[model samples]
Target: MASTIKPVLPTSYKAAVIEAPGAPLKVIDVTLKKPGPSQVLVKVLACGICHSDAGLQQGHFGPHLFPRVPGHEIVGDVVKIGGGVSRVANGDRVRGTWHGGHDHTCRQCHMGLFQICDNAVSNGISQDGGYAEFVLLRSEAVVRVPKDLDPAQVGPLLCAGVTVFNSIRKMKIEQGNLVAIQGIGGLGHLAIQYANKMGYKVAALSSGSEKRDLALKLGAHEFIDSSQVDPIKALKELGGAALIIATAPNPKSIAPLTGALGAAGKLCVLAPVGQLEINSFDLISKAASVHGWPSGHALDCEDAIDFARTHGVTCLVERFSLDNAQEAMDTMIQNKVRFRSVLVMGSE
Candidate 1:
């Protein structure tokens, strides 16, 4: 029993597509299909260009199917809803994340770990995403967003925001604990604000001194330039870190930070950086542990957005048009973007 109010369906729409690996994304017209049961058609308002998009386009995440639309952090309006869909309705603002669709019967799903479900379907990887005028999203994967929140800023919250927020929440660090956020990039910037707002003594660590002011402006109590000093020794001097969240993707940068943890300290890695050459003795000596957290489910995304809204935390974004997606993604890949790059589709 669903209401049937739909927008004028377009026969085709513009999309930025990757025809092949290592090829530039081309803006082209693609045919559209009516959403099937349990699905909803979204008029994409904005989408965040994440580092993962660059990795997928470069085939770093293994071989990818050609002609894919690569953008996972999606924010849009539910224009049409198919039968049996009641989670959202037409005119409702919604957001979708990396955790798209999954089999509800799986053990992971039953336990509310939909992000790690055995048959999880990635929105932009396994299927088409919001690098287009319109996107068809599985209803179950969609979460209602606050209508008052800026659509452009909330897109990254669907992925990067949720990932870091969930990871920090899992650490269960107490208030006033010393927390170190490594790499003042997209994820690190948000992590710093979140940790500080959560009552932790936040320290922002990066390779150079360029981001010192920016980090402090984002609520960090201190900033450490790793290139000028030994970061481990620096942290130890300040009573060590109760929690260190590594957002930098380079394993070399992460390996040394492991030794900066204090007794019973936890090191949480949010980057997709491939393996780390950690000294086991360092971990054993401090009774510390290293853990990795992936993106969260819809409820987690909602929680992150709510927390950010209440605390005035937001991502600093560079805007781009759909036609300029290549340039936007290139800027992100080169690490030239101030923080995040978002493709704004059109006005709401």
Candidate 2:
């Protein structure tokens, strides 16, 4: 059950703050403020380090202010709610989407597209994020977590899971449609599993043979090595992939797969590639569409978690204590973190 007690005495909370770009995070003591009206105070249990954090840290995603705590994949419990906040109660297990709080007055909101709210502020980026003992969120951004889900393992679901879910949902692949997932890493692995559960003929594309067996074991029906042979030709001979999901950062690695998209097929880019140079005439002739789907709304995020639960979708997470956050981040940077990396907090 969620706790509703509002502690009266102000107490210091531990937080990991990135003082500057490329600088190490500093652990600091902070005084957490009580939730104001329309706000809820969450005691963070775990947060997944996403590639977006790498961009924020390297200043690749524009100028993020200093002293920012870069973690958007947050799972926690609502400990307190401000006056008039009724969506969640104290002690509710919860997670927050990228939108910290969205302004419902935008045109997008009227169309039920609040995820693209013009005045939206995001967690860990536009606002203080989850790399702390406590964080504040507007009531609208919180998604109630299933009580049975493990807090640590569910952290990456906020971003990685939702990204793959949203992408696959948009693809509308039939049960036997040929689908290929590029880069069997964090997002790719989950994409492969999700696609398989969605009833698609799943294939995995990677640079090396190392991930070939793992990909097949993770529900991929076939695996292709871009290094050994032309993945486009291989996928073409395999009846061409109807839907290709690119989960790697390098656009060149995934660009060729555009040709592998059979007639009227689709290529979804989940990773933020620097740029994609495509043969427009070829794409137009094949009637292939290139799409990009970022994180979805709070409700969509909930749908993903519920779907995962129903389908037994899970992240193969490597756990690290909160104190080892730096090591965890380093592992993610080196792409050595198997599947996913999550920080575990609270008493076990």
Top-lDDT candidate index: 1
RMSD of each: 2.0, 1.7
Query: Candidate 1 lDDT, tens digit per residue, 95-116?
Result: 9789888899999999999999
**What is candidate 2's CA lDDT for residue 27?**
72
Q: What TM-score does candidate 1 get on C-alpha atoms?
A: 0.96
Quantify all predictions' global Cα lDDT against the true fold.
0.89, 0.84
Tens-digit lDDT track of model 2 for 76-119: 88888899997889889889768678889999888777778899
- Estimate the TM-score of every prediction: 0.96, 0.95
Q: C-alpha displacement of 153 in model 1, angstroms?
A: 0.5
Error of 2 at 197 (Å): 0.4
Which residue segments of model 2 deviate by more than 4 Å?
1-10, 62-64, 346-348
